[model samples]
Target: MNKKVWLIYGMLALATSTWGSAFIAGKYAVLSFEPATVAFLRFFGAAILLFPIMWIMVKNHTKPTLKDYGLFAILGLTGIAIYNICFFLASKHAPVIKSSLFIASNPVLIVLLSGLFLKEKITKNNIIGMIIALTGVAFIITNGHLLTLFQLGFEPIDWILLGAVVSWALYSVVGKIVLKKYTSVESTTYAVAFGTLFLLPFALFETTWQDVQLATWDAWVAIAHMSVFVTVVSFIMYYQGIKEVGAAKASIFINVMPVSAVIMATVFLGESFTFAHGIGAVCVLTGVYVGTNTKKWTLFKRQNKLRVQTKDSA
Candidate 1:
C-alpha cells in the first residue's frame, strides 16, 4: 500500500518471474548440453558471483568446522547437484510448464517433511491442502485421467521432476539446521561451491572441452540467465523481500513463478496450454494458498474477535 511495500512487492514479483524463466532457459540449455553439463555450468557460474557477495555482505562470518563442511556437502548434494540434474533432465523430456508446476508443489512436500522430521505442526488445513495439491499434480501428470495411474505408471520424466522436488525438500530441511549456524547467504554459497565440485566429475563425463567450446550462443545465454538472474540477482531480491514483508507474504509471490513459466513457455517454446493444465493450475494454486495461509487467517480472525470484545466491554 505504501511506496516501500509496493516496491518490495514489485521486487518479489520480478524475482519470482526470474524463477519461472529458469524453466524456459533450462529447456533451451538442455538442447545444446547434457543435463549434468547444464547443471554444472549454471551453478559453477553462480558460485563465482555468490562467494564474493557473501564475503562483502556478511561481515561477521564465522569459519565452518569439519561438521559444518559435512552439512554443506549434504546441502550441495541434494539442493544443487541432484536437484538441478533432475531439473534439466525433466526439462529435456517434459514441458517446461509441467516441470515448473512440479517444482512449485515443493512447499507441500516441504511442509509434510518438516512436520515429520522437524517436529513441526501439521494442521488439518495442511493435510487437506496437500491432498488437493497432489491431486492437481496427478491430474497434470495423467492428462486429467486419474484412473490411468493404475494402468500406466508415472512417466520417467515425472519421476525425475519428482526427484527434483524431493531433493529440494531435503535441502530445505537440512537448511534449517545449517541456518542455525550460518546466514542463508553463507549456507547457500557453501552449498553451491560443494555442488559445483560434486558436479564436475559428472559434467566432465558428459561433456568434452570440444563440446564446451562448440556450445551454441543460446545455450550460454540460457546458462547465464539461470546463474545471474535466477540464482544470484533474484535470490538477493527475494531475500530483501523477506526482510521487508516477512516470509509468509514473501512466499505468496511464488505463485507467480509457475504462471510466468507458463507464459514464457507458451510464447518462447510455443507450448500448448491444455484444459488439463488449467484445471491443475487452479487446484495447485488453491491448495498452496490454503495450506500456507490457513494458520495466518485463523489467527487474524481470532485477534479481530478479541478486539471487538474489548471494544464492547469498554
Candidate 2:
C-alpha cells in the first residue's frame, strides 16, 4: 500500500512476467541447443551484460569481503547454475505447464524451510495460505484429473526438477543472510558470476563447437530473451523486491508465475487454457492474497505509528 510495498509489488510482477514467458523462450532455445549449452549461454550472457553495471557499482560503493563473495558463490551455484540446468532437463520430459506448477511449490517450501532454519514464525494464516496455493497449483497441473495422481509416476526429469526446487529454496534461505552483508546488486552479480563459472565445464561436456554454429535464429532469440530479460533483469528486480519485502512475503509472488505462464503459452505457443486453468488461477490469486495480506495490515499500522512518532519528535 505504501511506496516501498508498491515498488516491491511492481518488481515482483515484472520478474514473474519475465520468468513466465521464459518457458516458451527456453522451449524454443532447447530445440537447437543442448540443455546445458542453453544454461551456459544464458548465464554467460547475463554475466557479460551485468559486468559493466557491477563494475560501476563496485567502483562507487564499498566492496564486499571475501566471506561475502563465498556466500554469493554458493547462492549463484545453487540458484542460477543448478536450477537452470535441472529445469532445462525437466522440460525435456514434461509439459511446460506441469514443470511450472512444480516450481510454484517453491514458495511453500520456503516458508517451511524458513520456519525450520531461520526460526521464522509460521502462523495459522501461513498454513492456510500455503494449502490454498498448493491446491491451486495442483489443480492447474493435474488439469482437474485427480485420478491421474495414481497413473502419474516420477521420471528422472522429475527428480531433476525436484532437485532444482530444493536448490532454489536453499538459495533463497541463504540469500537472506548474504543480503545482510552485501548490497543486492553486489550479491546478485557475484553469485551470477560464480554460477557462470561453475556452468562452463558442464556446458563444454554437453556441447560441441558445431552445436553452437548449428543453432537457429529462433534459438538465438530465445537465448537472448532468457539471458537479458529473465536471467539478468528479472533477477535484479527479484532481489530488489526481496530487499524491500522480506523473503517470505516476496516469495508469494511466485504463485503468479503459473498464471502468467499459462497466459503466455496460450497467446504465443497456442496452448489451450481450460476451465481448470481459470479455477487454478483464482485459487492462486486467493492464496497469494491470504498469505501476503495477513501480516501486511499489522505492518502498515506499525509504520504509521513510527511515522507519527518521528513527526511529533521533529
Candidate 3:
C-alpha cells in the first residue's frame, strides 16, 4: 500500500474519533437547547469559522455558476442542516453510544446507494461485510433482543437517528459528484453557508434570546468543538480520504466510529462497558478486517509472485 494512502487513513481515523465524541457534545447541548437550536448554533459557528477561508478562496477564483450554487444548496441542506437536526433530536432520547451504532450504518447505505446509481458492482465480500457490521449494530442497539423491534413502545429517537444516517449517506454520494467540479474546501464552505441559511428560520422559531443567554460555558465549548472538529476538520479529512481511496473502500472506515464513541462514553461519561459491547466491537472489527484486508493480501501475493518470476527470467 502507498504511504500516502496510509496517511489518509490515519487522518480519517482521527476524524472519525472526533465525530464519535460529537455525540457526547450534542447530548449536552440539547439538554438545554432545542434540537433546531443546537443545529443552528453548530452551523452558525461553522459558518463563522469557514466564511473567511471561503471568501479567500472565492477571491482567488471566479464566482460559481447558478448550477454550482444549486448543488451547494442541496449539499448544505442534506449534509449539514438536516443531518445535524436529526442527530441532535436522536441524541436527546437515545444514548450516544446507541446512536453511534445506528449512524455507523451510513456506510452500508452509501454502498448500496452507490451500487444502485453509480452502477458499482456488489460482490459477495461486500454482502458478507455489510451483514456482519449490521448484525453487530443490531446487537448494540437491540441489546441482543431481536424481537424488541416490535415491542409495545419504541424510541422515536432510533427512527430519527436512522433518518440522519440516510441523510448523511445521500449527502456523501451526492457530494462525490459535486466534488468532481469543485475543490473539497470550496464545496464544503458553500454547502455549510447554504445550510446555515436553510436552517435560519427554523432555528429562529425554536431558539430564544433566553436560551442563548442561559447557555453554560460547557455548552459553548461543546458547540465550538462541534463546529471546529466535527463540522470542519472531520468533513475536510473525510473528503480527502474519500479522494485518496474510492468511496466504496473509504466508507468501510465508518465501522470505527461506533467503537470510538462507545469507548469515549465509557471513559468520560461513566457509561458501562458491557459484555454485549465487547462482542459487538469484535464482530465489527472482524468484518472490517475481512472485508478490507482480504483483497489487499491477494494483491500483495500476486505482486510478489510476479516479481519472483521476473527475477528468474533475468
Q: Which candidate is the best by TM-score?
A: 1
In order, what lDDT does every prediction score?
0.92, 0.78, 0.78
lDDT of 3 by residue, 198-274 (tens): 88998889888998899888888888899989988797788778877876666666666787888888787777876
| Every candidate's CA RMSD | 3.3, 6.8, 5.0
Residue 305, model 1: lDDT of 100
TM-score of 2: 0.81
Candidate 1, run of 10 with poorest lDDT: 292-301
lDDT of 1 by residue, 164-194 (tens): 9999999999998999999889999999999
| Candidate 2 Cα misplacement greater than 4 A, ranges | 1-12, 58-66, 237-256, 296-314
By TM-score, is 1 or 3 better?
A: 1
Candidate 1 lDDT score relative to the true structure: 0.92
**Residue 275 accuracy (lDDT) in model 1:** 93
lDDT at 81 for candidate 2? 85
- When summed lDDT is taken over every stretch of 10 residues in candidate 2, the lowest stretch is 284-293
lDDT of 2 by residue, 230-281 (tens): 9778877887788778766777777668778767777887777778767766
- Per-residue lDDT of 141 in model 2: 61
- TM for every model, in the order presented, reads 0.94, 0.81, 0.82
